[model samples]
Target: MSGLSIPIHPITHNPTEAWEQIKPTQRVIKLNVKTPTTPQNENMLRFVCMSDTHCLTSHLQFEIPDGDVFVHAGDFTRCGSAIEIEEFNSWIGSLPHKHKVVIAGNHELSFDPKFTCGPAARQQHKNAHTGGGLINEIPDLGIERAKLKAAVEAENTVNLITNATYLQDEPLTICGIKLYGTPWQPEFCNWAFNLPRGKQCLDKWDAIPAETDVLITHTPPVGHGDLCCTGVRAGCVELLSTVQSRVKPKYHVFGHIHEGYGVTSDGKIIFINASTCNINYVPVNPPIVFDVPIPPGFSK
Candidate 1:
């Protein structure tokens, strides 16, 4: 990371036009960065992204194309099992990318409880789900004590990948850029980072500090990279609005809707839906790569 100074996209123009050769369907494993490969430049950088892996260890172990940073959108596990979480984390931390950032998908319930409840929340939810019955008041299942115990066990016991483990609501800096991962998703049955529409998820994006170089999430925004053949948009509308309007990251990477694999750009932001798994739940998609120039003075 010390001597690595290269401008991934060097032309003084729009990146989409410069990298138009890249396709949404064609499989590409590498993107070459020009001579300057470090973050000292004013504006240039490269990032690698993959999403919806669902615990495909082979894809995780296979050599990922080179880049300055690696971003995983979400769904690292099939059921957020302790085994799957460790397996994915171990594999993700090993990539050549200088930094690795990830968010929890609907599958990893242990870390993201926004969409889940401990015994108390789960019980309260169960009561409501059972009959939508009116309750004198929502009972706090009081499962925190037990939940914390389980969470600690997972983080400590599960094997670690690169000494970097899953971080919640925390920011990690790589090279000179800032990276953040939010595991929240749209409202759905008990799932990881689940948030309701409107105020629920928007509140999450408000915490992202400005100049965030990269944002990682499990679900894509409504229109950009999120689409379903079911004639419905299954992504988070609030996240889309907040990220595109507020964070304005150089890259927004996500996966969950497998069919959304590909690249979409709003002229300023490059959206990569890097799902390692396909619609049929197969690890067919390859890692997508991009070169981003790190402007001089980019923070650590």
Candidate 2:
């Protein structure tokens, strides 16, 4: 990703009017520091974050820096095959970070039974019933689906990634920081963690714990880092509302739409779309790194 300097919201005498002019569309600048470094007397937790690797770890051009924690927001595999999952797990195991947090992306079909067995089977049944009609219109995997199902059952049922804590709609605290990870996004191309817009999606987001300090999701909140190359904004509006109004996580990290790889902030929340791949699916985008100070008087 380009090290493009974003426009920061300047502090003004008129606080109310200044905030009103700071729209989510306005890009908030990222720290220009290449590596996370601690200043005097600050207990900063350095995080090395990358997402949407899509099984392209071998092609990565840059080195992942050492940090207190490593976060893979999602899309560790191109397809959610058991072999791919194991490979990603092995790679995660090799990383030097002490705490590694991973969340599933929309592509991780086996992680969600609703997509693989429940809805997929039901849709297949419906297609057969309706003289070859299609739901979601994603191509039938046929034998591939059968193979993937078996692989998921055998390898991914109990322990998918041995080295990292994989979370789905769950919160985990590491070194005094309360973090929540969720894979759900607004329905798009019918992938995993997809819920319909409005109530369905909003209800899922409503599950976010109010005290979350770090929010890891696979999709960018609307109007933040979700602008597609084609000019269409593919983000969850409801997610943005939830993040801004209620959850208000200090840092929100995600990746799915590869084109939307960068950092932005809306005063309170720093949104990082750390998509590791480019639009062409090359794992060339650099891992975004940053530091968040451990909250005062907090214990692990």
Candidate 3:
């Protein structure tokens, strides 16, 4: 399925089988969407956030839960491949939510992320060194993480998803609340969507607006819900700084770290890491649900 592509129906009243086929065995969370006729009377709009589903279509049978909008941070597919994307899109479209926001993670390499034409893959290592891509040297023992990450993504083993096909990256208003999303993850040993620290990842974080009412990110900020297998926080320090300083959205939802499938808050901002899969890729974390107040400035 190198160039796999599947068509997806928009969010609608699709049959249960539509989602069942994609997901074979998994717990499902049934969510209820607000009625269109209902007024934005509630001070807060209900929001449900989930991520790292890894193509767990079986989970869909449980119902997506109720909320003003449905948000997917990233890693919606196992390999992020075209086939996986279509599977995800089709299932997502079946949901009857007012709006849906999504973004691509390093694993969700929707397009040809491999830098077959980039300088890194073709970079030369003289001094008795043979041909090696740009990932040859890094803190993770110079394992050429970038090239490996790309290879795995392109392989579509988990199905490649990417920034190109990502769900939503710009400021969006739903039920009178502002929302934004970013899919970049921290530097890992050659994983997809990994952004280097300092300016590399910070640049993308800078793109987020300060007044965003709801922020959807694929990965968590440093010290928030970002923990690795070693129990060390693998989140981007710069992202943590940027999000706290420059981008102070009311609610930030993400789910790259499955181990930390819980919610945290900064008194002002609500952080949710609804990882349906555990750190070991088990469907443990349930979908996170909460209601956000709607300021008078926003509209439906």
Candidate that scores best on lDDT: 2
Which candidate would rank higher by lDDT, 1 or 3?
Answer: 1
lDDT minimum window of 10 residues, candidate 1:
1-10
Better candidate by TM-score, 1 or 3: 1
- All models, RMSD in angstroms: 11.0, 8.1, 14.3
Pick the winner on lDDT between candidates 1 and 2: 2
lDDT of 2: 0.74
In candidate 1, stretches whose alpha carbon ends up further than 4 angstroms from where it belongs are 1-44, 59-63, 114-165, 298-300
Error of 2 at 142 (Å): 14
How far residue 274's Cα lies from its native spot in candidate 1, in Å, is 1.0
Ranking by TM-score: 2, 1, 3
TM-score of each: 0.69, 0.81, 0.69
Prediction 3 TM-score vs. true? 0.69
Superior by TM-score: candidate 2 or candidate 3: 2
> Candidate 2 at 107: error in angstroms?
0.6
Candidate 1: residue 217 Cα off by (Å): 1.7
> What is candidate 2's lDDT per residue for 71-179, written digit by digit as tens?
9999897558778888999999999988999999877766776644566555754664454422234433343545444443443442768899999889999868989
Of models 2 and 3, which has the larger lDDT?
Answer: 2
159 in model 2: Cα distance from truth in Å?
A: 1.9
The local distance difference test score of model 1 is: 0.61
